[model samples]
Target: MKTLKIGNTTVDTVLEWSGNLFDVGAFWPGRSWDAVEAERDWMEPHFIAPKDKSKPGVLAASIHTYVIRTPRHTILVDTCNGNHKTRKTIPPFNNLNTDYMEKMAALGVKPEEVDYVMCTHLHLDHVGWNTKLENGRWVPTFPKARYIFAKTEYDHWFANMNGHAMDGSFEDSVLPVVEAGRADLVENDFAIDDSIWLEPAPGHTPGSVCINLVSGGGSALFTGDCFHHPIQIANPDWSTQFCSDLAGSATARRKIIDKICDTDTYILAAHFMDPTAGRIVRNKDRWKLKI
Candidate 1:
């Protein structure tokens, strides 16, 4: 649980769950087991999965949300998977039973106090908390908050409602927010305030974006799925199999790495394990995450 202040705004994390779920070799397709094994000492316990029958060797991840408290508003970045969501494609994420709200409350943030909910992309894990089940009906969890969604990202998934990418999330979590008239579809570079804004970093998904926070003199970048594991920070061209456009994802990742590496900007990864936020640095001719 780390917190940082950017000028007048403070950013904190409320974790839902953290553990390994995917095999390391398979999670990053084309990656060699040797490369993964070499990083064992650094990845173990937090990022690496213990050997098991289901997935013998995999990389675990943290599922959580960032609470951004500005002087005038409270904003949340990327709601983690919610309880009772039907995600059959990934059984572990399906019908989850985590005390997400309790954790949110522990942060002194009631759902009603949230002014905006921003999702870097509408993936199952990222948008599941947008709505919750109540009395047999799905409704916006943060009733007072306007859910900010990139128009390009929403349109693509809404049009292909049944696409695997949607994976029933559009119908269950996202559509309900829109139907409830709480969705604020905006452009990729939309700004929420003088110190907060969205930056286009499409590739992993059509509308994928990053939330930027700059207050006082501090700066941080809440990168969505643009870089899942810190390993990707060392190898910007290593696009995950889940990326819709491999080349585009690599290009975008490289560009971001170049922009933030060796700077004060903190890279707030969406699925990174504990101590998820850190800065990138130059490692010889490559890069590394210094958490």
Candidate 2:
């Protein structure tokens, strides 16, 4: 486990899994490795897997949750792919099991002790852990926590429940929470306290948000899918195929780069590999994440 401090708050990562999961070309359609060849030095082995003549270039990614402890609250930002869920479209995440809860226990926090469960969006991977299978029925994983969801984001998925576009997560992982009355559908700009709040960062999903945390003199942004890989730092215009709105996602990516570039604020991207938290800096005319 890796711990980070933002002023008086403490943040830790509960990793589900990580690896070179997707081919670079397929992840970002039409984008080639040459576009980011200049960054091969730092990208290899983490962001971009080393090249192999037997296969296409692949991008490294991690699925995990951030456990944030403020002076007054214990918060979890984006629940990673939960265990035993069926993700038909995303075969990599289907009906799997892992020691995710044990990892949380090692951090000295139990599921019931969590004060809030915040989802950046309602995507399958981001919300899978919202519920767990118990006796063949899905139930809220955090028995006593309030699960927060953006109103726009929730409504979008809620209306499309009849379909299976999201790999059946809307029904299995999210609905159970809502039916249990543990869901909080708030505006995109909802705030939790003086040090934390939500900021609208649409494009990846209509209701996707960036959770902002400011305390004492330290600051960090939990960017959910804003930039899946560090390569986006240099190529802000390359939106992944998963983004609901490609152009909007690209614009949001640029906005995030502009907000953190050459600054002390840390970026905790959802899918970035190890040493996932870092600051964006200017490299001549391009931007790079200094981890």
Superposing all C-alpha atoms, what RMSD in Å does each candidate have to the true structure?
2.2, 1.7
lDDT score, candidate 2: 0.88
Model 1: which residue pairs collide? 7-215, 7-216, 20-60, 23-58, 24-58
Among all windows of 10 consecutive residues in model 1, the one with the lowest summed lDDT is 48-57
TM-score of candidate 1 against the unseen true structure: 0.94
Least lDDT summed over 10 consecutive residues: which range in candidate 2? 48-57
What lDDT is obtained when candidate 1 is compared to the true structure? 0.85
Candidate 1 ranges with C-alpha deviation above 4 Å: 40-56
- Residue-by-residue lDDT tens digits, candidate 2, 49-159: 566621356776899999999988899999988999877787888887999999999999988889999999988889988999999999999999999999999998888
Per-residue C-alpha lDDT of model 1 across residues 106-175, encoded as one tens digit per residue = 8899999999999999888898899999999899999999999999999989887766546788898999
**CA displacement after TM-score superposition, residue 18 of candidate 2 (Å):** 0.8
User: By TM-score, who's the top model here?
Assistant: 2
Q: Which portions of model 2 show Cα errors greater than 4 Å?
A: 50-55, 162-165
lDDT of each: 0.85, 0.88
All candidates: TM-score: 0.94, 0.96
